[model samples]
Target: MSLMPDRKTIMLVLKDVTQENQYKREKLEQERKFIEQTRMAQMGEMISMIAHQWRQPLSSISATSMNMMIKIQLGEYNLETKEGRDECENSFVGQLEKIEIYTQNLTTTINDFRNFYKPNKLPVLTSLKSVVEKSLKIIEGSLHNDNINIIYDYNFNEKIELYDSELMQVVLNIFKNAQDNFKEKGIEKPLIKITTKERSLIICDNGGGIPEEIMKNIFDPYFSTKDEKNGTGLGLYMSKTIVEDHHKGSLHVDNQEAVEGEGIGACFTIKLNLSSQSMEG
Candidate 1:
């Protein structure tokens, strides 16, 4: 017969186990709520971006339609003449093609957003280039509408073990922050440069840098430099958590400037491991 622990000892051990399980449950619940809230916030931003992107294309389509109608009403577009009819038909077809292109772009944007919001059950080997490109596609509309120029540098063709969508979320958050800063400060010639190294990426924007006073607390929950009307303050905090706590990576920020006082900008740097392993840890 095997000897077991005394009754009192067994009770104590069981109590500890129960407490630990309860703590884990509570932590899991909190994480679930946080993820949900963050997703909702991102969806709201996506809607705004879609509106900005759709507006120009929709306006072009409307103007094209009106022009065609006017031409027809004025008898300038004559179906009887091959040349005149061909000209009008070509113009209409061209506008329809443009509309189709824009519509396809919008559909792709929605798909990206939907894929990103899904839960990642396990880490997969994904290329950094693809991840960055996908993140850019989601926000390209907003960037274009704001007239901000994006410069991509560096190349990472190798794969990394990560939840790609989570990493994409971090990239999107940093990019949107830079964009917001540029618009808020009215920066002329706004530019965002993204460069990647073997296992890291640096995103910098020429929108002026974060103030030293608030830099330390930038990643703290509920700490926001933007006014309440513009920010919920969880973005950077969540990004940090995703990088450090979830992916076992590093996320840092610095003020980058070529000279003492010129081209001062905020730079966010992220580093990840290149190995494949269990993300559950």
Candidate 2:
């Protein structure tokens, strides 16, 4: 008869395995919390952008209403005279049209944020150009406020199967980081350049380059160069996870340099494989 394992040996091995599993569970829980924190921060930033986007339209509507009231008070909007009535009617119609346009813009902003933050049920083939455009819309207000110029060069025409919302989040995060850097450093003529290639995209900022000493640590969790009030340090880490870990793609960064050996800020590159078959919802 073959000898069987002793009770003490079996119990010791089982105990070790149990402890290892418990340790893994704890680590996973911590990571889950970190991801949630970053996501909440992103939502808050998006809301700020929405507020900015709505401000101009709301002001315009208010001004138009005030003007109409002023005209009425001055007895310039008489309904009895055909000329006065026509002028009043035209002014009213113009104001109404302006209000309609503003209302549509507000509605679109809400929908874009909602869709961008909604959890994805599954990965699908998505156009990169569409994703970039949506991400820009989400943060356009913030960029304008910071007086940063954006240049987009879409050189590729293809779709990749992936989580669209996740990708957009990554793109938005990068842009927000660039904007903050420009503000903090007070860079002159701040610019963000986004260029697409056959299967990759590059985002470069003119807010000076990442220091060589800290470049390698940029992707590490909870590692941020910004002051505590402005940064949680999880944005870039989570962005790396979404691009490289979750999507089976690649995300890397480097200091863009000129041929004369001058630093030209940092460039983050993302690459994804083109999907042969598109997935349906």
- lDDT per model, in order? 0.82, 0.83
Q: Show where candidate 1 strays beyond 4 Å.
A: 1-15, 81-91, 258-263, 276-281
Estimate the TM-score of every prediction.
0.84, 0.87
Clashes of each: 0, 0
lDDT (tens digit, per residue) of candidate 1 on 1-281: 33665544433433348888999999889877776777777788888877876677677777877876887798887788999889888888987788788678767777887888777889878777778898987888899988988888876556778889999999999999999998889988888888877778789888889889998999987787888767788889889989998888899998988212366999999998658432231
Candidate whose TM-score is highest: 2
What does candidate 2's lDDT look like per residue over 1-281, in tens digits?
A: 43664533333433458888999999889878878989987777877899888888888888888987888898877789999889999988998898899889889988999898788878877777778998988889878888888888888777777788989989998998888888888887788888888778889887788888999999888898888777889999989888886788899999886212345788999997646343243
Candidate 2 segments exceeding 4 Å error: 1-24, 258-262, 274-281
Q: In terms of lDDT, which candidate is strongest?
A: 2
Q: List the residue pairs that clash in candidate 1.
A: none
